[model samples]
Target: MPTLSKLVCAALTCLAVQLPAHADNTDGSFQTAPSFSWWSGDKSANNNATGGGGVFGGRSLSVDGLINSAKNLIGLPYRAGGTSPTSGFDCSGFVQYVFKHAANVDLPRTSRDMAQVGQSVSRDNLRPGDMVFFAHTRGGGNRISHVGVYVGEGHFIHSPSTGKTIQINSMDSGYWSSKFVTARRVTD
Candidate 1:
């Protein structure tokens, strides 16, 4: 006894409700946040507006924001000793710029100083926001001569060279992996 239009409306409503929430429009794939809730309980209380507290609090947000901001500058031209996007940037300059803008963390001008500022961490234990140092074109037993931000999953973002643009490179890549020196974690 229901009208045809009413029947179609009811069916559509049921379908809509049954569809999973957070489904991507492009492919209708369901997406979920990683279970790790970086911020919780006491940690949340300690993370003031200034972004203090350890990695468990707003620090994670800082890392994520920094990574996102770094990714946004994928094609920026590399300029030696340049810090701002307007002037372009060198490797350390690019890292400093991203951290300053995204996490409000000011880093030293040179890669060597930047490496000295943070706590040393092993490559196997590196987390997001950690710094990865390398010798670049240097040969054996040489000190670290380059640095990049570890954005996670064995990948890093940096201003590679004079003519190269700011971009992500795989840590597993022979060129990079062979040159990799060490990793450091500046923030908790």
Candidate 2:
């Protein structure tokens, strides 16, 4: 009998060969990617890594790899609309780039459009790979100008502003709390 690890590996291998480069966009509607929740499960697996437990078994990589990749850019200068380390990044650009490279998930380019790509989720229910939006410098009811990746533990990773570096921030902080607009789950 195939073990759970073997089954997961076989499934992912089949998915890798069968899944299309882009997710389905039928009926002029976008659906959240079915593999989005894999990020949270990856994190849990890594956190449980103890005594060579082999928590991570399949070809699917861990979210810690994604988070660590993002963390490597901490202190990188911010640039408007930037998407690479050499150029720096805006909030949404940072999220898009990180997910694309680290998790191979393609996201919309702009913050507003990206907000619409995921399922609406409250901040209380946010998990890894979820997107958190904020008003940032924007004011009034038309909030939602900045975006970030929720990396767990009430913290999010984002490219804040010009002259600022990409960094992790607490959602509970007063500045973020006041500016936070909404959170969305783009993955399963």
Candidate 3:
């Protein structure tokens, strides 16, 4: 039977030979090229420095990353028309900030306009990274006046009205469920 060292060497030799071309050393030892990354072919690691996907652009958007980004802003106070972390965020501003920062996708500044940008997604089919819109009963019927990033499990993150901080609320909650206007998917 082959010794463990020999088996490992044989495997490495096969891998090195199968991988992309790289400079060969005079010594018969295995040397992995910088490009020879993800031995298991897992692309989920965003920045492994050895060939993980780079964040940015629509092609690289990660739903988990986007949801995490929105969740990180929880507890931030809401300010009317606010657009940045320093200034705090309103509903639409929170959605805009999360998408632009996490996925490099710029969104309209207002919830109503944002509702027009992406393909409509039914509430039953809602997925993480989808933008969930809402309209208050007293204010414009069916007009989207609020926006949040769905974090899955029927929960969404948003910076609600004045004096309220960013928070995660259940879409099934009486207040929010009744207010839900529609959902849109801005990323794949």
Scored by lDDT, model 1 comes in at: 0.68
By TM-score, the best candidate is 3
Clashing pairs in 2: 36-187
lDDT of 3: 0.70
lDDT of 2 at 184: 77
The TM-score, computed over Cα atoms with residue i paired to residue i, of candidate 1 is: 0.67
- Kindly list the per-residue Cα lDDT of model 3 for residues 1-188, writing each as its tens digit: 99999999668656643655244233211123212222223345222211332233335676756765775576688999999899899889899999889878888899999999877999998866788999984755897788987765576778878877786666885468788989987675
Query: Which rank order by TM-score, best down to worst?
Result: 3, 1, 2
Task: State the displacement of the C-alpha of residue 137, model 2, in Å, after optimal TM-score superposition.
Answer: 3.2
Per-candidate TM-score against the hidden true structure: 0.67, 0.66, 0.68
Highest-scoring model, lDDT:
3
Candidate 1, residues 37-142, lDDT tens digits: the string is 2211234322222363234223433666665577667668889888888889899999888877877777888898888876899989877678899886635664
lDDT for each residue of candidate 2 in 1-188, tens digit (9 for 90 to 100)? 99999999668555543444245333211122122333334434333123222122232334565665676576687898798999889888898888778667778898888888757999887766678898866346755799987767676778888877786666775467677888876454
Clashes of each: 0, 1, 0
lDDT of each: 0.68, 0.66, 0.70
User: Order of candidates by lDDT, top first?
Assistant: 3, 1, 2
